[model samples]
Target: MEAKLYDGPMIDAHQHFWQPQINPHPWLAPDVLIPFRYGDYSAIKREYLPPDYLKDATPKHNVVATVYVDAEWDPKDPMGETKYIHTVAEKYGMPNAVVAQAWLHADDVEAVLKAQSQYPLVRSVRHKPAGALSPAEAQSGIRTLMSDEKWRQGYALLAKFGLNFDLQTPWWNLHEAKRLALDFPDTLIILNHTGLPYDRSAEGLKEWHKAMSLLSDIPNIVVKISGIGLPDKKWDINDNRWIVQETVQIFGTDRAMFASNFPVDSLCGDLETIFTGFKEAVKDYSPEDQHKLFFANAKKYYKMKI
Candidate 1:
C-alpha cells in the first residue's frame, strides 16, 4: 500500500532563522564552534533567513506558517534576536509566531520577559533549563534546575504576561519538568525534541519512554515531535518511526504536533526527507488525527492566528 502524505496546511511549531553576520550567535560563530548533536554544522553557520527556509520547505511541503524559536543569539542582549526576527517577519511575511529567548535565572529576566511580551509576534519564551548529563548526576542539587527557587521566581513571571514556555532538555530530566508543570498548572510547557531520545539503545529508549509517560500525565504540558535527527546517522524512517509514533501515543494527538526543527535537522536530511519520514510514520492514522498532528495542534498550542 502506498503511504499517504499529509497534504494539509502545516504550522511548523518550531524552527529558527539566523544571520550571524548581523546578530552574534556565538555558537554559530566561526571560531567558537561548540559541540553539536549533529557533529559539524558548518554548512548551516551561514545566513538562514525566510527565503532560505522557504526554499527548503516549499515545493515539497505546504508550510503555511511557522513559529521561530530563538537561535541562541548573544545572551548579553536577548531582545536582539527577537528584534531581528520581527524585522525578518515584517519583510518576509512568514514566521507567523515566535518563541523568544530569556534566561529564567538571569537577574534581568523580568525586564527581558516584559519586553518580549510586548512584541505581537512573540508567543512564548525558551530558557533551556540546566540539567544533569546523566541520571546519576541528577541529584547533585543543581541550582539552575527547575527546582531552583530563584529560577522559579523568574519562571513565575511568565504567567503574569501570559507567555508559554518552550522546554528543551534531555529525557532523564523530565521528572523535574513533570513537577514544574504541576507547580505552575496555569502555564503551558511545550517540550521540545520529543524529549531528545538520542541514545537509541534498548535501555535508553526504555528510560526515554518512562520519562515521556510520566511527563504526559501533566495536563498543562504539550510536546513537539522534532529534532529527532541522530548524530552520524542518516535520517531514516526505520530509525525514527517508533519515536514519532510513540510520542503521539504518549501525548495523544491533541497534545502533540509535528515540527521541522529545520536547518538544524537539515544536518541529517533535507526538509522534504524529514517531513516525509513524519508523514510515512503515521500514514495509518485517521485523517482527523493526522490533521491535528500536522497542523491543528500547533495552531492551537502556539495560539497562531492563521
Candidate 2:
C-alpha cells in the first residue's frame, strides 16, 4: 500500500535524539536485545541527532515541531538526557517540546521534578511505571511500578510543576492506567505507542481494544497514534489502517494525535513511510480532524508555542 504524501504542517508527537558517546544509554549496549515488537534495533544503536532525523523526515514531512520523549538512557542521570536534548533542540530548531525521564519512585523525586520543571521546554515526564499487572500477565520486562505509594506520591508532584505525564505501558496495564488517570484527574495523561498493543493475535487485539475503550472514558486521557509497527512488524499501510481508524474512533480527533516514534520506528521503515502510512490510514476523515491529528492537538497537549 503506497502512501499518499500529506503536505501539512505536522508535529511529531513523539521521537528521540541520543548521543551514546557523550551520554550513557545502557539500552544501546551491543549485547542488549529488545523484544520482537521493536524488531531488531541494531541499525539505530548509533547516535541519532536532529540533523540525522531531519535528513530522513524533511523530504516527506513538513515537521514544524517535535516532542522529544526520553530515550531510556542511564537512569542514574535523567537530567543529563534532558540537558543534551535541549542543546539538540537549540541547534536543530525542532523537537520544540521535551519529555524528560523521571523515576517517580526515586528518593529525590521532588528535587528531580523541580530541576526538570525549571526548563521551559520540559513539558512532561515519560515514566514507564512498573505497573500493577498480575504475575501471569506480567512479561519478563514488566515491573510492579505505578502501584507503589511512594511513586504515586511522586506522580502527584507533576501537577505542582505544571507538567503532564507521558505514559508508555502495555495493553495489559491500561486498566491500571485508567485508575491513575481517574486518581489524577487534574493531570493530563498522554498514552504512548498506541497503548502498546504488543500482542497482535485476534485475542490480543480484542484485549487491546477493550483496554482502550475503558481508558477512553476518562476525558483527560489522550492517545498517540504511533508505533503500530511494533507488533505489526511488517509495516503494511493496509494492515495499519484499522489500528489507526480504531484509535481515532475510540479517542476521537480532539484527544488523539499523530506521532513518528522515529528512530525506534525507523527499524520498521523510513520516516516517509511512517507519516505517509498515517496519512493514508486517516484519509477518510475530514481535513479539520486530519489537521488536529497532524498538528493542533500536539501543540495544545505539549504547549509547543511553535
TM-scores for every candidate against the unseen true structure: 0.97, 0.93
- In Å, residue 38's CA in model 2 sits off its true spot by 2.3
Worst 10 residues of 1 by lDDT: 136-145
Q: Write the per-residue lDDT of candidate 1 for residues 1-306, one digit (tens) a residue.
A: 555777888888899988877778889888776878899898888888889998998887899999999988889989988888998999999799999999998899999999999999998999988768776677564423598888999999999999999999988888889989999998999999999998999998998999899976788999999999888888988999999999999999899999999878888988988998899999988888899999999898888888
Compare the candidates by lDDT and give the number of the best one: 1
Over 4 Å off in model 2, which ranges?
A: 1-5, 34-36, 132-143, 230-233
Model-by-model lDDT, in order?
A: 0.89, 0.85
Please give the lDDT score at residue 291 for candidate 2.
Answer: 90
Q: Over the stretch 267-287, how does candidate 2's per-residue lDDT look in tens digits?
A: 887888888889888877777
lDDT at 22, model 1: 73
**Clash pairs detected, candidate 2:** 130-143, 130-145, 131-145
RMSD of 1: 1.5
**In candidate 1, which residue ranges exceed 4 Å CA deviation?**
1-3, 139-144
- Residue 212 C-alpha lDDT in model 1: 96
